[model samples]
Target: MKRIAVVGASLAGVRAAQELRAQGYDGGIVLIGSEAHLPYDRPPLSKAFLAGTVSAASLELLDAGDLASLALDFRLGVRATAVEPAARRVLLSDGGSVHADGVVIATGGRARTVPGWSGVHTLRTVDDALALRAALVPGVRVVVIGAGFIGAEVASTCRSLGLDVTVLEALDAPMAPVLGPALAAVCARLHLDHGTDLRCGVSVTAVGPAGVHLADGSLVPADVVVAGIGMTPATEWLAGSGLTVSVGVCVDTGLVTSLPNVVAVGDVARYGGRRHEHWTNASEQAPVAVANLLAGRTSRTYSPSGYVWSDQYSGRLQLAGHPSPADTFSVVDGELSSSSFAAVWQRNGETVGVFALNNAKLFNRLRRPLRRPAVV
Candidate 1:
């Protein structure tokens, strides 16, 4: 390929570009991004950055020298309208087009927002964090909708700043689908222990100036509201692009879309019937996708690492492997009520998942077995 266009300057896209260069592909790379700023780390946006503990510059994924080495035709602040796989061209919103031999669709998802609610804020970008940070002040009653990782992190940051925080979850338990009821209860306790008024199994009807309106006619008064429900995959631009997009841009194990020349990665890619929005998943899929894209077919299959970590309250939460409610959970070290512990989920007799809180060493040791690939 003479040139490759990588859509979305996200972690996955940046990694894809780097992988191409590393693999001795000395071709033209057009890194397209909708954001004006260079690709930056997004994990800190809801925590340290929102809490004013980290600067914007510290979040950059690449330095000036590193970026210069990649030899990228950086197209920042422009949205990709559509892709023509057969013609090998990407249509841009600026009335321009990027014609390349290959295309990488890494357009990650955007944070879900509440419509018709001007007062509600959703944290996804640097601008979103900055806007929310400015609104957060002393004694502001902050009500966070959704008790997922992002919502919990936002509430934890707010509480750290000495703000009154209350988190609402539509489900019976936060992260129940992944953590299951047993471990999910531990997550719920973590919020309560940190002095957060966490309410589960609640339905939110509307968001007005007064506060959040519930279906049962109860109002949760708040001076500031943040919606951390989830993210919607940014696949609107690929509507007529001939790629199978179901919730996300559907791809096979090789991260190759329906078109041989096109591939996807990160939160926007639904690989092997599952889409992981984790940082590790995004970074790991790039190499495989780049390989398959260059090979023009499925040469290597992508396997999920199933690793995710979060910082909230006093401990660092970590999980590895695919854990479901059906799996049996047993604590290996320390107690669940304690500040530090490591646990594993078992299916029949085989261990399927591992979880830890402030116990990195043990967790890392236990994670190795799960990382081993199965013999076909």
Candidate 2:
């Protein structure tokens, strides 16, 4: 392939371009991004960046030296409207098209916001974070809807700023499905322990300049409201593009789409019926996807590490492997109530998942078994 077009200049796209160069493919690369800013780290957007501890420049993934070495044709602030697989052309929003030998779709996703709500915040991009950060003044009342990872992090940051914060969750136990009941309860306590008004199993009816209106007709007065519900994969542009798209652009185990010359990655890709929004998943899929794309077929199947981490309050929570509510939970070290512990979920005799809160050392040790490659 003489030229390859990588859509979405975020983590997955940048990594794919880097992988191409690392694999000795010194061909032309066109890296396209919807956002005007350079590709930057996103995990920090909800944590340190929101807390004012990190600078905007510090979040950048590639510096001038790195960009020069990669020799990428960087196209910033442009959106991919459609893909013509047969012609190997990508239609952009700016009335232009990029014709390449191979195309990589890594458009990630966009934050979901409440309808009929104006001026309410939803954190996804750097621009969204900046707007929310400006609204999060000291002594302001912050109401964060949804108790998922992002909502919890926003509440934690608000508390850190000495602002009045409240977190609302539709589920009785936040993240119960992912972390299981035993561990999720531990997350609940962390909020209360930090003086956050966390209400569970509540339904929000509406949000406005006044505050968040509950299903019970009660209003949680707030100067700032942030909806951390979830994100919708940015696949609207790929409509009628001849690629299978459902929740996201559907791809096979090798990250190859319906078209052999095109592949999807990151949050925009629903691989093997699952879409992972984790940084590790996006980073890990790039090399394998690039390899398969260059080979003109599925030469390598992508193996997920199932690793994800979150920073909340004053603790670091880490998980490896898939942990479901049905799995048998066991506390291997420390206690969950103490804010520092290591635990595991097992099915029969095999360790299926591992979790740690503020206990990275033990977490790493326990995660070793999960990271081992299975024998053929």
Best by lDDT: 1
lDDT of 2 by residue, 140-239 (tens): 9999999988999888888999999999999998888888788889999989999999999999988888999999999999899999999999999988
lDDT of 1 by residue, 186-294 (tens): 8999999989999999999999999999999999999999999899999999988889999999998889998888999999999778789999999988888998899
Report, for all candidates in order, the number of backbone clashes: 0, 0
Per-model TM values vs. the true structure: 0.98, 0.98
Deviation in Å, model 2, residue 336 alpha carbon: 1.2
- Model 1: pairs clashing at backbone N, Cα or C within 3 Å: none
For model 1 the local lDDT of residue 349 reads 92
Candidate 1 lDDT score relative to the true structure: 0.92
For all candidates in order, the CA lDDT equals 0.92, 0.90
